[model samples]
Target chain A: MQQSQAPISSSSAVNRRGLRPRLTLLLGGILGIILLLDLEPYATRWLQPGGDIIFWDLHFPRVFAAAIGGIALSWSGLMMQTLFRNPLAGPFLIGITPGATFGVALVTYLGASMGLEDSGTSFALQPLAALGGAMLVLSIQLLLQKKLTQLHSLLLVGLVLGYFFGAAVDIITQTAQAQQVKQFVMWGMGGFDRVLPSQLILLGSSALIGLLILLYHRHAFNAYLLGDIHVESAGKSVKNLRLWLIIGSASMAAIVTAYCGPVSFVGLIAPHLSRKIQGTESHGPNILTSAFAGAALTLTADLLANQLIPNTVLPINAILSIIGAPVVIFMLARKD
Target chain B: MKTQRVLSAITTLSALILGLASCGEHPRDANKSDIVWIKNAYATLFRVGYSGTDSFLELYTDAQSKKIAGAFHWGTSAAIQGYEKLKDRSKIVSLSAIHTGMLAELNAHRHLVGVESRKYIAHPLLQEKSTINSLSEVAPDGPILPEKLAFCNPTLMFGTLSSIEDKQAIERQAKGKFSVLWCNNHLENHPLGRAEWIIAFGWVMGKAEKAQGQFNTVKKDYESLVVEAKKSAGTHPKVITNCVYNGMWFVPQYSSYVSQFIRDAGGEPITAENGTGSNVVNIEKAVGLFSEADIWINTDLCTTLNCLKSSDPRVQHIKAFRNGKAYHFNKQLQANGSNPYWDMGCIYPNRILSDLFHIFRDDLPTDSTYYYDICK
Candidate 1:
């Protein structure tokens, strides 16, 4: 039996391919519905004191703040993975979270007696301190690049810095008053719930700037993906591209770390999920997908966390750890 | 000239002999008038098996010994009873009254020289007259500043079991400066010990007869109340005494002074099984033990009805909560105007028993009036 393909059937195959855009729009619409339904009223009631219109207006900024945080962290994850060629890299791995934690602890435990006016200011400045701390480590790694050939050295350095910062935090917490320590412990639980409305502007603006920088350098990102030697052989400046990528990633990491606390695993896992879903090695699709997925995942997890106990809310990190750890493990297993 | 000089010398010699003779006569006269007899009032009043009825006669007889310049009363209720007995005989120049209302009796307005703490130093009269000093601040290591104490020249010091620990320090501080007396009204250190100490204070104040009468009255009243409580004991409801700290509930253990109040009131204490320690137990354990108890008594300083209403939330969970059976201790009974309640009420367990019996025992023939008023 012989089968003959008709010219009309070939044209229908092209039309079916054209329907992919509508399918994507439908999938996005469903996810957007889930996000809007899960987040809006619940976040509104949880953060704002009263159901008054004025209070709801005040709560709007925090919603946008978290949205901005989700985008920045996802984009930062994408940039770091592209630059480092490592899927497990994120703000926490680079010692940024611990560094920021240490800054907050120092101010909380020691600053009051030292006559610091605003204790929360120290917490707000943590990301700046963390950026410096991460850069210092990064610079040290760069300096030792000739001496240390293994990527494990950089990872080990980051680990040691994290432990060192952690020990410093412990010392600060030990001398703190019982009540103050309890508060610090609660904040350390890591959630978007603590972000104030006023911080939205700063978080949103920095995230926008970082996204624009990454978008503008999209060609350089593609060049670097082919390897530094190949890009340099193609007559593009690999060193300049690497520098810009690191700066962009570091800034994005710092902004998110400052506002939303260290949202562990989202930065590491979201990019990988995006790459797998897109089934393409292209950075543009990966970036867009990762941003959407990260926001969706964070919003969904936060929703589940809020709903778990009827009146009481658990930390967002606890939920993320449960969901994120398993997905990352599965992905790694599949890659192997 | 020689004859004139001899006349002058003779006159001078005669004047000197007359002066010596007058001086000798003056000594004899002074001995007769000023040598008053010294009295041992305490020893006479507190003699073995001595009753409190003859306290007045003992005090009057002791008055003939010497004018009592000052007196130190340190015994708890015994001091109050002793002061009342000797109020006419002695001008109580200085006193260290520990109980709340006991200071009101001194009537020496503003004469209170020292206090245990700021929380306990709210007397209007004492506030005007005395410079407040905390017992801890003045005598952290003991031998309370005798010089500071000497300024007031307190002849007597009154204290409860709580102050018993500082007795030696007080005495050392008062050595040669003042006398220290022990008041055992709480009887907490001993069940029947407080009434006996009243006799001792009476003897010290030379009011043995008056102390004996007061002691007899209290003893008789307590015995009758105990009998009444025992009669209706079976109908007495079980009670849990507690206060809130942070979010946790602190239940009184079996052996606390509060437990005695509960038991004497004819109610069984829920924590009675723990056996008389004052350590606060956890809420879970307390709830487990007293979940079925008929009443929850908030023994905190809830002086008013309003204050009792605003008490900690944990109070709402007890069975007593559903029935509104919670009772707060009235603060009015803290002291009799110038006397310490700890010395008086704390030492005299019978009075506390009577109050508790009135509150808890149904159909008990106890005084219905609360000795202390709830703050409200």
Candidate 2:
């Protein structure tokens, strides 16, 4: 699976790869320690013995979900950027997260209109709603790609769809009651700590499965990076590969968004960080490196958001944007 | 590509199916005349109210409902309207926010199921509606779910009908056959006018005479409190409200009902210069207001001064915080976070006024506050 247009010599590339994985492991260890030790005054019970209910119910799920969700979103972002050959492309930048948002809006608003806004059943099915919304956008993108020759044009379609879904969400928010609107707004702000203990395993497994699929097709991604001509000459249908990649990436985003809300930074920033650190376009190393980096960033962000105020939990998305926006700009500037 | 098309088509179809499924409404069935209505505060803002066999009551529209919902004294407008309209007000089985002004009325009718705050729960006169049946032991953990309310099996649901959850419950249980009176009480700007919602409540319950009579006493008591507050010629304490939630500070507008209480209690309220609704400002601006203010109220459910300070240490710099004049509207709370101060506080602005007057004036012998507790 070695690239024909490789920039670095084989020996140097191998040595760099060996060093990057160790750095990633070190970063992951430091992040894990930060997350575990940075408990708020009220969350002290999380570390005490016989705190199973507290740990399993209140704490572990959130930390695990944040790490897993970050890995999934970063992995998806890598797949998206590689497939589109566009550095800026990520799930949230396109319509995938918005599609998930739309699905939640559908359930929330439609339920509100029918006078069932506060029903437990409505909240219980949020993951399904998110998945449906995500699938809707993914399907549209797949269908449109068949006719449109340019991938950048496809990016335009995703942006437009994002706006359409966003508008729909706003309209429904206006019609819904104050409490219901508040719930939706909180969900939109995005947080990792919202996942329930019951949902942790399901979300973790889905993310793991998505990560495995990406790992298996690491060679395919390398071939696609070489361009569609290379991939076609290798007897792989570029069209089918693109479709599968979209599905895989969109599914990861949708699942994480459904469980933990629409996180921003991991999907867009982590992949860039991976490529920068690895200094190569190889999917194998970049994929693992991005996942580890994404997890570290998210865990650290979640810790800050949780403990920034003594009693109040600040929105995770707000903290992520504060962190992610500058990183993206810096990357663009450095690339420039 | 063929496989991709097939999968894409399937995904679209699945989205449509889910969309349609979510659009489904819970089936409701009930006879309007046979059911009684229970209401939350927000639902009282609409013009129309409940429908019964003998009447389709238009709450805010009718001259009587309008007059009472306009009045600030709890049950006063209802009492006045009941005398003119000649209806029994006692049949209105609505949850009362138990406060001083309505204590007499509520005590007189022990059948009424009131949502008492923790302070009022200990009141000697707290109504003992058939303890086995009248009281809903299932305290709803969050916003009143339809099921918790369904236990009441209300025939005439009185509210603004704005909450989709409440609407669905009524729809499913009553099957579009029950009466849902729109109570637009929150819309009334006049302190007395906001209290007059009892007239609408009276009409629903067929207890006009009792509602009117009860409201008259509240009017008299509330007027006397106002008269007492008017005697304070000293400087009006600069008042601020609410603490930060999720890093944003929300202060009520000058036109807000809470500000009206501050004004009536002889205190100057700090509000946003513009906007008729709550103003969302950053922490720095909110802290500036807090530091400058003489008194702070409604510290976002922070019952203790320590809770307030711990949430934001900058609050310690406020004059109100140093003077121990910071108060919370959470004088009464349930373990589940339900506070009747919200439910009944609107019905008795005079009590809230009395509470604020006590908080602001050092000259006056401190009166027992009904809805506020000094955060210390």
Candidate 3:
């Protein structure tokens, strides 16, 4: 029972946590399989002395982006689900993604109107701006959640915030020049291939930081699952824990959205699918399983998006929506 | 006698271009001349009112159908572009008007007989030119309406591919009453190739000799302009065209009209790839291409250098912007705010080439023939 109440290391619970390890390996195996399957052709085409620019510039950067983006969004989704104690809470659903998008659009569209190149270093500060916007929406949602006791009310408020941010983005885009509007609109469509080799370090670092934060609060997360009362009883400030949780989760979502263009449904689908596979409420197995599931799902969606058409990448958001919506329906239909 | 003189001159040019025997296709007998003025080679087929006779033609357009009707018909429908610009307006009959402000002018000129749409009455450009304005008018969003067009009673209708489906609907309504012949001259990648369609149009109007004469002049002028431009080939600058639209920068294909103009003007055109048509690359790729260029031309709809920079500040990063080589087609605007570059330049590519030569080659004599000017 203490194993469920506290965070347990693999050394202390080998036999009892056999499912977690197997689930991790299975999800990890799927991710590996997809990466290898997708990369083998590109890898074979890669010239040793840097002969092929397409292999190096296009394919290699794309693979890492998909993997890293998947991990970040799915892990962020898990954090949001636990923090809100709602199965349906997600970055997109809860206004965090829209806020990040609004932030990027502001710089991309409004900045261009101010005579800044949408393609140049003016767009380089997008992640920070996205983080600010994500935080703005997340803080408002959290503050409103204190008054609105109902889970659906909070979701509704988040949806309203999403609409508001979306309207702001539209207004900003209307004033932008045509090319900037095209860039803004394309960025809204979401794709993995947009991440250049230079952007990978920032994306990878954000994911690593978010994961570390989640791991650091692993114990507090498990305690909070029992309710805010149980978390307080354990001598933790519920408000502080919630704040950190939201910040960590929102940052992860913001970073991914800012770089990859508001990836749809991955944040909502990955955790639920991971929870079903792991079949546990504990943070260690759930988080690991969810992260792997998220990575696997994103990579697979990205692979389908890439391969579905030759030489053209289908939008990642569209592919994810097609794959993610059905799994959500299945989860809702299940008696559990 | 004037027609005979022009015909004789065209006969010489046609003999050189199409061979002597082909030039002799001009009818010799007076009876044949009245019955079939143009030969089948240059003549376009019209539906001719379901009677299977290809004869009379009528044309309608949004503002201007590129002065197409005026070139073929002595006086185009009063509703078309060139009625006032190129033709004797008194000789032209009134057709449907799309803009209400223009409709009042049409009425004042005793030419307001038909209207294409009652849906859109307010036109921003037309409002600026004329006092007669309507609050609400149905604008032609799709093809020319069969009902509105019925009033025009055209034997032949001219339209572009954009209105191909709409033209089909009109064909269905007219069914033997008219034939819609879409002018695909713009599809020609070469400037002369586009202008040469005027000969094809003239043939339809039983004016093949006149069309041939006009085309000969255009050919001679264009070839002379090319020869003048090539003189400064060694000093040609690198030129890029068109500003960013919706974050994707459009560069003319190597074979496009503008690119050909750039080449003939003794300047090298910068393109992302050796594509046959315009390429729409994102801002990043566009920035890379634009940065290396010496001059930028056709920054579409951007009136000033500051406006161009505001569209994308990275425009300032380009050598063209830094060196003040940014130019736009803001020189010749119609009363209704339409760019005559598309209207007039299509007919006179020689002038376009002359302007580019002036821009690219400092050695060239600067003339008042520029269709474009520096974006301040």
Candidate 4:
């Protein structure tokens, strides 16, 4: 009955040529101009001989910190997007940032409870503790991988881990000294200014190594687009590759989270923007594009954080959250 | 497109290099030896008196022609003592420093190269100088221009005990580069220590005789006050320091500094079982211990009568709150014109003793507020 009723039909489809490289370059140029404009007054002040050297001195360190931090965050975002293969997957989604925060909270609050003479030991020990916490969560995800065939199952597990970590942090904070609690609250607000020159090597190298690793495995990532079984049939050890990718991504995410406090949504939004621009989900193009875009976004946000108020700086996370949340919402709504 | 990307990358690299190079122009005459000296006597004294930990003092005395700089973060009293013993201040050419009130007393305000925090931007000199909130915020090249520091020419620098994280790093930064002295205050660090450090600072600033006389007066006055408190011991009431706020009640540990004052004033102190540590107790624990505490004292000087009246809601729950027996000690009383309360209290414990006696003993005299409004 259906064979008799069948009719041939044709619909016109638009051919969109690749112009993303030029577009990205144009956007980067615009952002650079805006940054220069925002920074001009300080430059002029610094150039003027004997015109408040103190203010000029303060400005240099802050600007350097912001630049370094922007680069690190952007690279971290690119690596995470490539590893997870989920458009919405970011550092915050995997609970790495929260896990790191839990580590710092444990050190600052719990260390105070334990009667440690040196308060700085808490800060010194936070990165290693955070790395341990992130690994723990990663191991849990790996154990549940067989049962958690669906992405939703993995996400739900991550959300539960996040909640568990948050509850533990709150309990530790309650027992801590009021002064120590105040210090933790201030740290949690997240500032690029906190990144010292000494920490730059550690943060910068880890992010670079993670991005390089992701770049080397671009072909495997492209195969991942056809789903796990197809890639497995193509003679690649998909399980081992997936584990390494997760470890690399989680390690990068965990370090940034530990050092800079939890920065949200950059990983998710940057890759999505890159994919939309490329008009294909090819790993090679997406990774490079996402890294550049992430850096640009973070740098611009930091510029706003510093310049929004004349003499004061807002938290880096606050600026990113304001810009990121709406874009994510728009992407989800458009998909729906 | 690839060529353009390369060109843009080069342009960005060149810009960054230019920016960094511009930052590198060191201030002229940036050597530590070039600045005017205020005193050099403290060097002679340290060379003679202190032999236990020569690691710190050796930095000041044995350095070469190159200017050395180190961060000092401990021993405020010891710093004061060392400085007071010093014969000259002029040898100290630059200082990475803080604590404006103490700086004013030393009269070495111009030597400040950098400040540790912006919390005291309200201070006139710091308002005019560069300040960083945290040491971790310092740039790789160091925030202060060597030329500016050279003009100030400080050979040695000092700070509070908490500011130093790595003494070795500080020494490395200053060893053959600058001399660093660690200043720790006795009252903050030690439970029962003297104000010999004031003499130390005087020695550093080349004011040894003035420091000696000031130290003597403080010691003599404290002894007399102790005797006065003892005179009216029979009539003295039971007292507690009430140092901590516990939501429902004021908590007073028997081992706190305030407890020492209460004991010296001839009052029986509750919470004498708690040790000398500044541990905070819960409201429940505080209430259980001091359910019948007669007097509640608020030691915070920044809060005015109105501010305290509004902020402290728990003040209404305790027996002391019901009786309106709360009193505040004025922080300004610790200062004599420009000198710090630390110097005042440590040197003249008698004045504090006298104040405590007046509060506890009905026959003793006190200020009008403590007399008519507070005790009654």
Candidate 5:
């Protein structure tokens, strides 16, 4: 057991390099908070135990939900990208968001439910339907994982399923009157403000628990990036790692989609931005950085949404596309 | 680089929504056949129509408006044709300002450019449009030109399909790439159902929150009046509604909002059932229902028993006409034969509800009645 001194030095250097991502995370958090508080009735009136109704109820919940949404989506994206060994793997791309959207379309189109609170022993079935839809798609993908075997086939199936669910949503919208199925289409438009103040608890706790699971297993996630043979040779259960990855990402993505509608660009763009900043494939730093970057991007888009026209909040999803689309196009079209 | 190529591929794939489903039959028309929920007021309150595009992107790219609320009144006509959300305040034309008080909103339309107001306005709106346009023209757009935004008034009850100027303007503006804002309040047969139309008006006026508040207050007052009237010591009047016009007596059905108003006001309404709109009765049934009546309402043609006698000498046997308790919603009748009751009445159902309450029980000051008038 001759320990190479070079390995020791490399490990120390890695710890020192970790400081950059931590600093970046701090800055990102600061930016997100500042943006959240920057809007009108602008002041920290939200701290006064219900001073301003606008701040206490509307803006704070929306901004906080948006931050959590960014983190969850980016973390979900990181998990998918690393697991698939592709930067493009996002929760939306693999049919999860579309599946949740499909559930929303069905719920709203049928007029079966829309968050009836006073009906004791009842909960809003809309979010649950969305969660169930995401899980259904993930379970199907997982089953296909056993049969498809190849990673490319898994990705392809995900792509096809995404389109399939999207069309299901399309058919749903087409069938229902524009007025009858208003909420059905509203789900697809994706809004941070759509998260109910009551749901903030479930959304926050569920997202945090999922993130903790990811953070706790970041080592196994890193091992997962080394491929099945490499992961097994490294004394890790590849199947277990892959299962956790799918479960963790699916739960977070499903939860966020259930709350925030179907957000885009945050997840797909976050990991790439993190990798650009950190320049490492290590899961621990990348996960933290990706979450921060996603939060920052989402908060920035939210800021633009509020400020775009006076007294109007543009759709957060549309703003994200306007920002993320160009960034992605630039990255793809770039020489390096 | 490999990253660049992979990233580009991902970007293209990310933008794809995979919209390849077989179209489904429009269910809005089927909502009428629903029979149960269709009668529920909220079901017809608002709707977001599709039929315009697979996605609402048909307007998304051109207009900077968001479809915050789809203010639709599901009527007895065909399915609503387009997806229309009036962009808040900024896009509302001034002609319709008197009803929704949109002159306050005229300040938001900076680049009102030119409004193709010729067909969109009847005489009342035309009177208001010139003043509104001059006031709305000063705002500057950095790069944008004036848009051909047309205003629609669906208040003309005698107007076809609850929307006239809009359908005509739609054809003309469709060529010029203009847009129209619509309200179908006339289709809502309930007074409050008509009044809830303010929420859509508020959306266009940039005071949707305020409209909702006003409506909530009105609803609260109306419901409270109903509760109060329940405690009053009075026998429930057997109320017959409407007069015979063109050899048929059309009365508000049991399911009609007018019937709901009468019932809510402590009156036992003599009416038909299992339908919306109005119920048509043959002469025999009409005479039979009216013979049992203790009160009569919604008579438009008769102000006096002699007038009622002249229209139909059969009025001599009517219980309400003999008792002198007959009422008509002709108080808001203007000099031009166009009544404000149809337009302004829907904006304040509490008033109408109160009027009926007073007619049935006599609590409110008689002179305070805004829509209903007692038959002398």
Candidate 6:
């Protein structure tokens, strides 16, 4: 119980506490799985062209992408919120999304200047460019997070960096050709459909390892809340802990942005919803709850985007906004 | 005499291209040549109600969404009520290069003074004009600015309902100086229907006879080619088109113009599972269709086999890629990404159909005259 109350090592490893929170995660996960299984865009038995490819190659990879994305964004949001002790804190606040967007736009501009076909296979390189951009900008924030004595300075810097990257994206949009701009816009819409069958291994394993490390050191994130000295006192290498935390959040945001494009609102809304739903002071349920919430919300949004119309695949961002804004508004309105 | 002259010219071209007789079909033989009637042979989105040279033209669009998108009209006919009047046709602003190409096909090139997408204009005539290059991209969120369009001093503007700019909003912005006519030439289900939009463009440009003449010759050429393509020996290859762009794999629908060409060319074309406009699917479904294909066409932006492999590594296993059967229509693409395949290809469906036909057949030469070529 003392370990449970401590800043690191939750004893959440084998504890039977937080039943409702645990159940919420389990049910949310189950619901997510069910929704993913049902995603068959081609109404007929056309999927029978390849044996269970509809599941293995198509839906499986897509579901893996969404789940991983959800976990990454939601966990990153939780980390940001806890470190800042602010409810409004999210991954996008650190300028990761904007930086990633700018990177994608920059690549489009370069390609256009090189006179490459605007809407062609050349877009295959966008994922790499986006990942590189997200990491570069995020690393600056993380380095400052380590160097700066105060969280407020880091927060202010992130806010400013968000603006900087935003202006950069806007500049690119203005100069690029209409066809080239259309490519960036399409990439911004974000979807799980972009994930390939081959990418599941890397994304899935990384997400699993991240989840396990967090689960085993259940109270480690709470120590992250207390900063570097506390993590060192709790028999953990402060440097390693800091590195892990920064890398985890940065990698999650970058990988999701690169593979699935910038999925907005999931990172911002999930942690807040998790805190409200968990209804407890213990940070033990915070990571798992928010990660589950993120996965469930994103999966539902994707399902709705696919099935809302007869044969149309609407943009995921549009559907997420529709689903997320209402939940956020209701939670705020209730203040329950 | 004019009809005879046009027919004679067409006969000569048909004889040169297909080496077959096309004189068997003639509209003037059945109807009075002096009546001056222009009818659409295959277009479904466009309907001409009257028989006279100056008649009401009805445009069909999306009506179910309650956005007020279907069946509009513009003409001088006072008899037809609820139709918008397009008073002046001296100058025109084409939003799409396809329309500009169609107008040029009718020898009404003088009417196209403004265009929203001047960069896409790959026609040598328009590209060499030099003044056409100055038609800047004017719209911020949509396709046109009223002030910029006003600067062009155009009488008619051809717009599409698909853009973010609403038709009513454009009508308000253009005011009386110009009228906005919504054209959905790309949305046509049949290849000939898309080509037949030239006739409507002709009517607007006061070149109805010229448009009809061009449409008739092409239609005859297309049908004859379809029949000739069917006569070739051996089985037609399984055909798939287009590569992934921005995560979505778009293919031609079964009833689409692309599929009709494949069917006519004696080849099997993999079609979208559903939908009419922009057949989109994820990679999984597309891969299922792609693997079954023996030949690929319209591979998006891949000018070479190396480019195709880079777009999707799975193409390496696709029979088309392995056999060097992958092809694209960017043969005449310029440094600025202006491919006449889309510009002129819309006006000449027969040329593309012939290209596909010859490519699909093993005995014939694979190299196309224009538009399509092998991605070596």
DockQ of each: 0.02, 0.02, 0.10, 0.01, 0.00, 0.28
Tens digit per residue, CA lDDT, model 2, A80-130 = 887688888888666999999989878866764553432234455567898
| Candidate 4 per-residue C-alpha lDDT over A120-190 given as tens digits, one digit per residue, 9 for 90 to 100 | 34445555677677777777877876566676677778888889888988787765544467556755766
Q: Write one digit per residue (lDDT tens) for candidate 6, span A1-336.
A: 333664433344326345665667675867667554555443345446554655565666777687777877887766566656566777677777888888888887886576454334456778888888888887897777678767678778878888999998888887676657867887898988878877766666656665665676557656656666666677786545555655666677777888788898887788877665566434677777887888887887777776677445778899988887897788778865
> Judged by DockQ cut-offs, is candidate 6 incorrect, acceptable, medium or high?
acceptable
Error of 4 at A194 (Å): 0.5
Which candidate gets the maximum TM-score versus the true structure?
6
> Can you write out model 5's per-residue Cα lDDT over B247-359, one digit (the tens) per residue?
24567777677787888888888876555666644332365457668888887635555555543445555678888878878786544344545544555667887888888
DockQ of 3: 0.10
How far residue A166's Cα lies from its native spot in candidate 3, in Å, is 3.2
Q: What's the i-RMS of each model? A: 15.2, 12.4, 7.7, 19.7, 26.6, 3.8
TM-score per model over all chains: 0.45, 0.52, 0.62, 0.45, 0.48, 0.80
Residue-level lDDT of model 6, residues B1-376, one tens digit each, is 9999999999988777663333222112212332333355788666554434335566776323323233334433332335565678787777788888887777776777777666677877777646566555545334467777667777878887655655556678788567777887777777888899888887777677888889999899999998887787368788998786566676777766778778887888787654455566766657766776889998866678877766555555567888898888877888766888887777888988888887887777876457788887
lDDT of 1 by residue, A1-336 (tens): 001111112343355655534544554665587567655664555544333422333334434545567778888888877766677888777666777677666655654445331223333444455455556555654565446545567567667878888998887776564434654565466555545455667777777877787778765676666567656665677666666666677677766665566677778877877666555445755567777777766776666755675333456688889999999999999879
Give the CA lDDT, 0 to 100, for residue A128 in model 4.
67
Question: Of models 2 and 6, which has the larger DockQ?
Answer: 6
Candidate 2 RMSD to the real structure: 20.9
lDDT of the structure predicted as candidate 5: 0.61
Residue pairs that clash (backbone atoms under 3 angstroms), model 5: A178-B48, A178-B49, A179-B47, A179-B48, B195-B346
Q: Which stretches of candidate 6 lie above 4 Å from their native place?
A: A1-25, A28-60, A115-121, A143-153, A174-182, A196-247, A268-281, A285-315, B1-38, B47-56, B62-87, B129-142, B162-169, B233-236
Question: Scoring only chain A, what TM-score does candidate 3 earn?
Answer: 0.87
lDDT of 3 by residue, B135-207 (tens): 1111243335555566555445444545556655755864656444455555566777666555544534445
For candidate 2, give the lDDT of residue A19: 77
Residue runs of model 5 more than 4 Å from their true location after superposition: A1-26, A29-43, A46-54, A112-123, B1-376
Question: Residue B133 in candidate 6 has what lDDT?
Answer: 60
Q: lDDT score of model 6?
A: 0.71
How displaced is residue A118 in candidate 2, in Å? 4.3
The C-alpha stretches of model 1 lying farther than 4 A from their native spots are A1-27, A39-58, A115-153, B1-376
